[model samples]
Target chain A: MSVQHVKIVKNVLAGNDQTAERNRARFNAAGVLAVNVIAAPGAGKTSLIVKTMAALGARARVGVIEGDIAGSIDTEKVLAAGACDAVQINTGGNCHLEAGMVQRALDDLDLDRLDIVFVENVGNLVCPTHWALGEQLKLCLPSTAEGHDKPIKYPEIFAVSDVIVLNKIDLSELVDFDRDFFYKAVRALNSHAPIFEISCRTGAGLSAWADWLLNQHPHLDTKTERLHHLSGAPGM
Target chain B: MHELSIASYLLESVEAQAQELGAQRVLAINLVAGERAGIVDDALQFSFDLLTPETLAEGAHINVRRTFMRFHCAPCDCEYSPKVGNFSCPDCGAVGQLTADGTELLIESIEIET
Candidate 1:
């Protein structure tokens, strides 16, 4: 048998990325800010969602997409937390949430009615970084209890995150979490992402976070236009 | 594991290409992965081995080439390979912006016996 060398170069992630761009267009058309919330399991993701909804109360209409491996528990929690709408995605043992999953969840949500949607990714730090869910912002939540070495170990997430929230700061003293070491590690990888230190239990430092989130919500006309521009629509 | 799913995708791609080219057997696959691509090489290889049995790619060799994350400073017009954690530009001290060099997971070529 003779060996035939057929040259075919292709990206493994191209399919997922195409779907992600489609999801992004849908979000842009609806003028909703989609935030991908990523962290390890039990890092106060649910509590932060609850506190964020409470903090943004009466100002903006918020929705949520909860991604878990098997249960709809977090979806129920967010709904109870007064989210305008919530949809749960069970990954069925997958370690991360891909764009295709989020695309399906968006179909269940009333995109036109909501101003912001938080996509709570499955609780794995490494795998989730590889997939883009068409979000305008990527939020990395690492609790102080998880220790300051998270950035050192998971540099990919820190480098790509738009914002980093150090949750469970109330337990910092108890855990001996070194703030200086954490900041140094994070800054080394990502210089622009704003790091927020907050205790979800006490609601401390949430006002600033809420204010920043509110400011990030794009105006309707500008958002649509900008998205159209980015997507290269026929007319400007 | 996500690697299992990724391996499945890779298999699908290989099968499709093999069918299109009308190749009888797949000898090997050339793959490229970047440091921040979120794929563990050993796990990917294990998944590939698990999934390729009794297929055209069964007993095929998957040769993976790993790449590191590289950054560039726009103002300084220089590109630098970051040392694991630090991404700042060395000379100008400007915040290094990530380029498209790394974070790639691609199937470069396939060797088939016809």
Candidate 2:
């Protein structure tokens, strides 16, 4: 038995990170701010996004990409909430959405007409964090129903999230959830990411979140011109 | 399980590495799994066995190095490993305000036979 060794070092393809880069560039070029919202099942991701859309509707033109293993309920909700456009992605049995899926969804959206695009990922805390969908901001919604120890258990997700939404705050008193412990866990994983405790059901603390989101909108006026030039190019 | 998908990626990475090194087969693959990664080693091994047949990593031994959750206390500046269900800082009596070190998932190295 002979032995040989070779090296072809690479990161696993949790998702198409390179394509995500391209998507980011495209979003930037088109003056669009894309945000990826991730959470576990029943974490109130849909409700929060709907609330966010409602809050931002008066100021920003919002679009949404709804990802799920099956069903279009969330997509319907987003569209009905007055989003400029809503694209539904059914991933079959896949646990999360990848950059490719978002890129494909973009084909159905008019980037010029929108100021912000929200990609609501499939409801899986572990898998969704590993996959980047070319969003400028990544938001993780951890509901009180899941308890405060979630940030401790899933540090990577919390660490990578630009913003952490402590959803279902209205139920915090009823549940055995600790607010101090949640803050501490989040601080440990990420000291910089802002934590927003909001209840989509009661519309508490959502305005602050919407205001912060507006602040993060990429400089679209410059990108819009750049994209206009690119669109005019012969090959493009 | 997501570990199945991870195992598939691991097999592909190991096989590619083995082929590049002119190795006939991969003998063992070592991985470091963090306690909080939510990956089950037994499930990963089961999936690896199912996925590695006819590949360079076929029948290879899967060695998983597990690490427990560690926390750093801000008040005492002490680093301590937390016990299950007790997420408090051992030195300062502070609620474990620090992050756990056990969420890592990586392929450390592989041993192969030419």
Candidate 3:
């Protein structure tokens, strides 16, 4: 037998990326704004979604894809709160949600009737940052209770996020959270992501975030509008 | 971690390439991963060893090459590798944009017995 060295230069995640692109196309065709919300557990991901739904009211029909290691509790909570429809994905021990799981979850929702879809990724700061779920925006929610050093500890997630939400601002003083330190750490890794300080419990600073979300909706009425939306897409 | 899935994909790529080359058994796989690739090397090796049994790559060895995350400071017109997990430029203290330099996870080559 002869020993041979075969060159096979390829990305391991290319398959998942292709599926993500396909999912993006599907969302675009249906004219739905998809946002992937990621954070650590107890970081107020579900709270933020419920609050956003309440703020949106009848303006948009929203659907949710709740990802967890094992439970449908979040799906039920969103449906009770105001989501038009919801789907739950139990990863069966996986720490992150892949594009294939999102693709399957999309089948359960009526994309034509929905205007927005929120994918609550399994609470993780590391693994989920590597997988693309074909989201138009990636929102990172870090609570004040978690401390200000999260950006320094989990720089990849902060760097990849399109928007950063500092939740639990109401407890900022109680926790002694240093705002300057947090902002500086985040800026070190990502200078462009807009940071929003909001208290989900008190509904403070929700309107600004809601308005920003509304502006991101691709009201694809004409060719010019489509181009305008594409031009403003984050990380595109 | 997601290293199991990554290992599965890596094995699939090796098997496809090995089959195309008409190889009987794979001897080793050379992989290049960046520091931010989000994979633990030990976990990947464990997954590979667990999955490679009874396959063409049953006894294959995995060789990993690590790359550091590099960035280009546009204002300073220079490229530099930031300190681990800190992406700001060392010289100017500016948030430099990432270059294509370090975000690669490529299957560089495979050593096989034909």
TM-score of each candidate structure, all chains considered together: 0.87, 0.84, 0.90
Residue B55, candidate 2: Cα error in Å is 2.6
Sorted by lDDT, highest first, which candidate order results? 3, 1, 2
Local error of candidate 2 at A196, Å? 1.5
Summarize candidate 1's per-residue lDDT along A1-236 as a digit string, tens digits: 78988888898877788889999999988889999999999898889989998998877778999999998988899998899999999988998899999999999999977888999999988999988889999999999999998987888899899999999999999999999889877876787999999999998889889889888887844654565577788433
TM-score order of candidates, best first? Answer: 3, 1, 2
Tell how far residue A219 is off in model 1, in angstroms: 1.7
| Residue A200 displacement (Å), model 2 | 1.7
Error of 1 at A96 (Å): 0.7
lDDT of each: 0.87, 0.81, 0.87
Q: DockQ of each model against the real complex?
A: 0.50, 0.40, 0.60
* lDDT (Cα, tens digit) per residue for candidate 2, span B1-114: 577767876777777678778788888887778776667888888989999888888898878788776777777887888765555686667754546477667777777887
Q: Which stretches of candidate 3 lie over 4 Å from their true place?
A: A220-236, B71-78, B84-100
Ten contiguous residues minimizing lDDT sum, candidate 1 chain A: A220-229
Provide the global lDDT of candidate 3 against the true structure: 0.87
RMSD of each: 5.8, 4.4, 5.4
i-RMSD per candidate, Å: 2.6, 3.5, 2.1
- Candidate 2, residues A1-236, lDDT tens digits: the string is 86543333245453366789989988987789998999999998888888998887667778999999999999899888888899999999788887889989989999987889989998888878877788999999999989889976777788778988888889998998898888876776677899888999999999999999888976744554565586784321
Native contacts conserved, per model: 0.72, 0.31, 0.79
In candidate 1, stretches whose alpha carbon ends up further than 4 angstroms from where it belongs are: A220-236, B70-101
lDDT of 1 by residue, B1-114 (tens): 579878887898898898898888999999998877877778888998899998888877888888887777788898888764455688887656666676779999999988
Q: Write the per-residue lDDT of candidate 3 for residues A55-121, one digit (tens) a residue.
A: 8876677899999999899999999998999999999999899999999999998887677899999
